[model samples]
Every structure is written in C-alpha cells, then in structure tokens.
Target: MIINKILNVDDYYYDVFMAISGTLTGFSANELQSTGLAETYYKHILGQIETATFLEFLNVSKSILENSFSQDQLRNAIQSEIMADPGMQDMSNNIITMWYLGTWEGTYVNELSYKESLVWNVMHAHPPGAKQPGFKSWAVQPVNSNS
Candidate 1:
C-alpha cells in the first residue's frame, strides 16, 4: 500500500488523480509524475491541510471526473463539484497551484509559489526573473523573457 501511503488514494484512484489533475492543469500525467507531485504535494502539503476538506476534495473530484471525457467535460465536472462544495474551489486551486508551482500554502489564499514550480519544466521555458540559464545569452527561446 505504499502508493496509497504516498498519494493517499487506492491504487485504482491514482489514474483518476492523474486524469483530473492533468486535464485541469493542461499537463500530461507523465509530466506530473516527472515532477514528483505525489511525494512533494500529496504526502507533504495535502497531508498538512484540513483532512476532511482535502479528502472530500479528492473524493468529489474523482467522482466528477469518472464519467467525463474531453477537456471541456473535465472542466465542467470540476466546476460542478466546486459548486456543490464552495470550499472545494480553494482545494482545487491549491491542487492546480501545487502542480504548476510545486508548493501549497495550506489554504492561506495567496498567489502560487513558483520557486520550485513544475511550470518551468512543462513550458520548457525559463521563469524570466527567477533563474534563467545563461542570462541575456539568448541561447534558449524565450517564451516570456524580456530583452
């Protein structure tokens, strides 16, 4: 049950998390796995959040995504789930933030933490001000880097 220990979900629901999170954040499941979301966020940050809210968020999110296909359907299911439980919006946002930013504030309701963000990896681009490789070198194609 190490997978459950790590992801806080049964083995079967692992794919559910992958699908919902990937569709919601527009990242591939492989991309998420590459960044170690289960170890960093699920076991650490999510484990520290309000247990009921976090668990409910997972349960409801999985339920919503179960019978859905396409990005739009996934979005709708998440929206419906959020409507059913307003607090889950915060949970959903935090999850997305965790994937893209690689850190969670435990419901502080603030901007995402991009210090160790996976977005930089997903985008195959630099974070502009953070830590750009070979500064002003113009070697890598700048997605948002200003000259």
Candidate 2:
C-alpha cells in the first residue's frame, strides 16, 4: 500500500516529465539530455512526497536507505506507476528494467539492452553539462533517483 502511494507520486512526476518535453518542437536528443528535466522532475516528486509525509506512512526507518525500501519494492513501484498511464504502459518494462540495470551496473553500462536505454543512455551520454540554473548541484548525480 505504501508502495502504491509512492507509485502514485512517481506517476505525477512522470506526467510532469511528459508535459515539459511534449511542448517542445524539434527537441533534439542533445537538448533533451542537456535540459536535465528528469532529474528535476524526480526531485520535485521526492519533495512533494516528503512534504506530504508519504514516506512516513511506510514506517521506514530514516537511518537506512536499503531498509527504507528494497530494490524490488522500488522497481515495482516504478513499474506500477509507469503502467498506470496509457502512454507509459507499453514502455513500462523497458523503463523499469533500464533503471534497475543503471542502478546496479552503473549508468555508464556500455551494453544496455532495452528501449529504456534511450532514456538512461541520454542521461548518461549528456550528463549535466553545466550547473543547472536554479539548483546548487549537477542534476545527473548517481543517487538522484534512489533517494
């Protein structure tokens, strides 16, 4: 149930990602990668969830990251969120799978094998080239999504 709630929050984040990119015309792959929107979008989701005490509902100990949420649980939450949207359902497995691989093998994996590779590959390929305008740190840090 807590994962479900988290998934709902992630779904909102995904929607925001789609909305931001959808409005762009001739949005080159480089531009998409350089925009660093996914990182911003994820942080926005975490902020909303934290502000709403969504994690508190899970009763996870704040001291430990692994104990707070197992990798499988996180994967399921992401998959569930992706599948709930018509536009994302078809790509849910690819998205979740890539995130899994990226987390485990490092985002620099040279042999990615999923459509979601496009997503992570782009992020990895064009990491935050310069400091993001409003944020204090680079957007594409390794721990961005894990938290």
Candidate 3:
C-alpha cells in the first residue's frame, strides 16, 4: 500500500509528502494505510525528486494534480528546480499542514454555528462544528464585506 510504503521510508521528507498528498486527496490516514495508491504516490514522488527538496517535490506534485500538468513533465521540472535550489531539502510539517488547509476548501466549516465550531474544534480543527458556544444567549449579527 502507498501509506505503508511511505511509512516504511525513514526519511522525513517522504512522511511529509505522504501527509500532504493524503490531505490534498482527501484520503484519511487509515484509508491511505489500506490502499495501493499510497505506494504508487510515494514512488511517483521519488521519481520527481532529483536533488531531494521537499518543497520542490510538493510544488511539482501540486502542479501535476491541481494544474493538470503531466506527471513526467512535472517530475522533470521538479528535478531541475531542485538541482538549482539544493537548500530546499528539508520539509516543515507546519508548512505542509497549511498547504493542505489552503488546498482543501472548507465550505461546510464556514457555515457552522459557533457551538458546532466548538464541537468540531475539539474533535478536529478543520470542518468546525455547526453550533457555537452560548448560541442561544447571543443575538445574530451581520457584517459587511467588500467581497
């Protein structure tokens, strides 16, 4: 399985890659652990790295999946980019987490009530719960936005 293959890799970069990929693809850790796609994805990620930078690999992967770039083309691009920026070899879990958040739109979360948000926040930060604390105690107010 892809998740197993990724988990087996001792490198932190591979771990971060798997995390980001799972987040982007909406695959839970359990799902990834059970499926073959995780390994396929990991191998694809390995093929994309030349100088072995996490960010470059992520950029290439994002372009391939999000912008519809071909896997081979994206891999080559990442290889050259990594060669030029050798300092990008490390991966930051926080950065990957943020990337995952930005990539995954939270339409449902935004519509949640304050109480719901609290419940969801306790279970998971994303997809905030629909009810808010003291929902019955507060008056509903409207705010203006330029958008």
The candidate scoring highest on TM-score is 1
Model 1: per-residue lDDT, tens digit, 46-72?
457776666676677676666665657
RMSD of each: 5.6, 15.8, 14.0
Candidate 1: where are CA atoms >4 Å away? 1-15, 106-116, 122-124, 127-137, 140-147
lDDT of 3: 0.42
Off by over 4 Å in 2: 1-68, 88-147
lDDT of the candidates, in the order given: 0.62, 0.35, 0.42
Model 1 clashing-pair count: 0
Give candidate 2's error at residue 35 in angstroms. Answer: 13
The C-alpha TM-scores of every prediction are: 0.66, 0.19, 0.31
* Deviation in Å, model 1, residue 30 alpha carbon: 0.5
Give lDDT: candidate 1, residue 139: 68
Q: What is the lDDT of residue 43 in candidate 2?
A: 47
The residue-level lDDT of candidate 1 at 31 comes to 67
Tell how far residue 96 is off in model 3, in angstroms: 15
CA lDDT, candidate 2, residue 110 = 31
